[model samples]
Target: MPKPLYQCRVLVTATSYGVHDPALKTTLESQVGEVVYNQSGRPFTAEELAALIPGFDACIAGLDRFDRQVIARADHLRVIARYGTGVDNIDLDAAREKGIIITNTPAANADSVAELTVGLILALARNIVVADRETRAGLWPRLQGISVNGKTVGLIGFGAIGRRVAQKLSGLGCQILAFDPYTDPASGEGLAHFTSREEVIASADFLSLHCPLTGQTRGMVDAAFLKSMKRGAFLINTARGELIDEAALIAALNEGHLRGAALDVFTRQPPGADHPLLAMPQVIVTPHMGAHSDHAANAMGWGALNNCLAVLRGEEPENRVV
Candidate 1:
């Protein structure tokens, strides 16, 4: 009798909801001998992940903390398939050392995130949430909101999402100013580039963050940075939460220095129920749903899954991050 075709074990460390997707589960069972899944969205501890990873041939991961120790312990692990675009949550150097291929779905959620950025900008500028609350409470207090048209909008990053945002705002008749070290000065048709962050902040009526969270960018927007902005200018962050200094932002809003601010990401996930930012009427916060659109999620899952299958079949996936 021929031995059972191929004995393969797979592990999926994705957030709870995606694990229930019929397509994802069916694909895993069809290819592997055994499959384990983590339903919790929280990052798994190193020891917990290490113990479970030893025999898995592949892993479909989320924003979980997969450090060097976890990678080292996965002797049988071959590939890591990320469910989202950002790979900052994982340690790339460690995966490379283990000869494990790391892959992510880039541009899969560009439209969703770009749309969220635009929505957040409008929500904050117009005090949409606050106005609705007051109206519901029978108070007809008329609060004047700023308009996007004719506003000088500054974009800090000029990647796929950033470029899309620039296009959207430009169509709305806003002057676009962008700053990205990687962007070619002559590339964009109508976008202008500034030499310094201070210059952009000082001149713009609205500032939107689109950069990745890196060593140089973490907490880059602090008190001194906010102070340089034009008075009453609005701030929007759809990028990583750690990119801005939360304390400084609260102070700015409280002091009436900034007209308003919008955040789709936070320094801490689910930032405790009573988080200071939640109490402020001048700030708008969303539960990190920028890439949660069904279209984007489906693309991310299928793309990452296909990449894993390619690696298993000895073909290099086009989206390999490592």
Candidate 2:
């Protein structure tokens, strides 16, 4: 006998789920018997998820730590609908073994993230943060800044977000060089010049990362990689945090090997008040807010909601990842 759709129980962990639009929540509640929201205000740890997952049929997930043990404890969980595109936080192998379907909303937040990446680039080039701080402190200091026009901008990955970024910067007259082994050259068209990783790294005036985090890319930006970069060039990461070695970055910035860095994600969430990166005025950091735009929020919410409902109703989801 099939479980009744109205008797299905769903768990939602994303903090901003349905925040921009109430219709997402209303639609989800109408389809499922019960919807439990995460009250923790942050991603739940594996232990916390292990305690709460046993009875749920589906989950609209955030960046929660969905490790092997957590998946093993999800006795009835059939699907996990990620609110954002990245699935690095979820343990795919364990989910596959457990026959738990995973779906993510691709391109849902691409524009939002790309916009922030450009903003960070501009902010870093112009030292906007320092200027704002000094001005608000009742000191008017004339600052020298570089122009983005004709600058050689490098992109580490040329996926959806990267492509969007390239398109946005085209009018700025930047020489966009991108490296992504998996992307087809035709896909980029006139947006970016696809090139070797080494060339992109060495030639860029401002290097931005848009790659997904994986075993191959973890800590790829180490001391050696950072040392090879063009002296005094800036680094920007709107991708995953673990991609760069934080200690190496700190050392590079300390010794003036790199001019500055702008980070939207970190190796650790809320990298604390006393974190070394926060103390550097040259570095700009945000609380992983690259995809928090209202438009992005609504799209992610609706996509995740639809995914959860589709799987629960025994239908195929549009964005099945595993």
* Number of the top TM-score candidate: 2
Residue 260, model 1: Cα distance from true site in angstroms: 1.4
Q: After superposition, how far is residue 171 of candidate 2 from its true place, in Å?
A: 1.1
Clash count per candidate: 0, 0
- Candidate 1 similarity to native, TM-score: 0.90
What would the per-residue lDDT of candidate 2 be over residues 64-160, giving only the tens digit for each residue? Answer: 9899999999999999999999999899999999999999999999999999999999999999999999999999999999999989999999998
State the TM-score for model 2.
Answer: 0.98
TM-score per candidate: 0.90, 0.98
Q: In model 1, where do residues sit more than 4 Å from their true spots? A: 1-6, 16-21, 41-48, 191-196
Candidate-wise lDDT, in order: 0.82, 0.94
* Deviation of model 2 at 82, angstroms: 0.7
- Any residue pairs clashing in model 1, and if so which? none
C-alpha RMSD of candidate 1: 2.9
